[model samples]
Target: MIRILAFVLTLGMLAACSAPPSSTGDEVQRLASEIRSLGPDIDPVEAERAARIAYSYSAQLAQEYEITDPPLVHNAKVNKGLRPRGLCWHWAEDIERRLDQEGFETLEMHRAIANADNPFRIDHSTAIISRKGETMRDGIVLDPWRYGGVLYWSPLTEDTKYEWVPRDAVLEKRRLDQHGALLPYVSG
Candidate 1:
């Protein structure tokens, strides 16, 4: 009974993923507007270009990654070596790398991690865009992995589902945790 229910749900998800994704013009515009709103100094042209590249490149990645399932399902496939790449960090890294090519003087790209301190949930990574001289907290989250390549973007403070922290901080903490774990406990 459990196996049959799982099969039905998988079929439904597969059917949902079969449809070709639509153009991202409206999404691009909305993202551009949000990017521009990051600060008064943000360049409108750069914002638009970044938004366009983010959405288009994400779609390209979706195809390259052969994303035929939801985010978690695709993650499982990637973990199982059934897919080459589609992980959250892959999305963040690829998007950040692609965006870096533009050399936007008024914009900065940041990487963040969430759920690093939570034992129950997996760590989530994403790229963020902010005005020059600002931190990730003042940036907008550009998350393409949330919906399995469908870009899910929002302002940093407004993204309620995840409490993001700087990527470096999380990595450093993880390193410390591992080092501590490796040390033998001394019962004094």
Candidate 2:
């Protein structure tokens, strides 16, 4: 009886640990696909319209790709090296440009190193969209050719800095120039 109980308990724990995180990725992707399916006459040039289109597209990509966590340097490194084309930045840039051409204002965001002494250095990029009359602001962190939506209100003045990276590390090196490198920096 004790052995069986222990086995069951272990199994339960494993299942809990492996459970999927938030479904934000799927939600984002679904929204994006819906927007893409809209009629061609639909103006993607208006800020409001563009915001809707970009948001939906971004959400769909997130859902389809299963990217739940905020974008990180390590995620970019692993996905870029292992995934097809190994061109994470290219995907991000293309998305941002596309959204912009469709009339949405886009901002390229970089995660600034929080600490001054740390040796490792890296940065990630994303697109921010501004739509009139909509109180909810949306931002996407692109890495691994995937966008992690940081859904919130517009003009994010306080939450712009990401807390995930270890602070105090001096910028040891910039990794963007390296062939096939995913992150902007590779720490020493």
Which prediction has the highest TM-score against the true structure? 1
Which residue pairs show collisions in model 1?
none
For model 1, how does the per-residue alpha-carbon lDDT over 1-188 read when each residue is reduced to its tens digit?
Answer: 99978966875675466343465558899999999998898899999999999999999999999998887778878998999999999999999999999999999999999998899788999999999999999999999898888888889999998999999999998899999999998899
Off by over 4 Å in 1: 1-25, 183-188
Position 112, candidate 2: lDDT: 24
lDDT of each: 0.91, 0.40
**lDDT digits (tens) for residues 38-83 of candidate 2:** 3343234343455464556555655544554434432544466642
Model 2: CA > 4 A from native: 1-45, 63-81, 85-91, 103-118, 129-154, 163-188
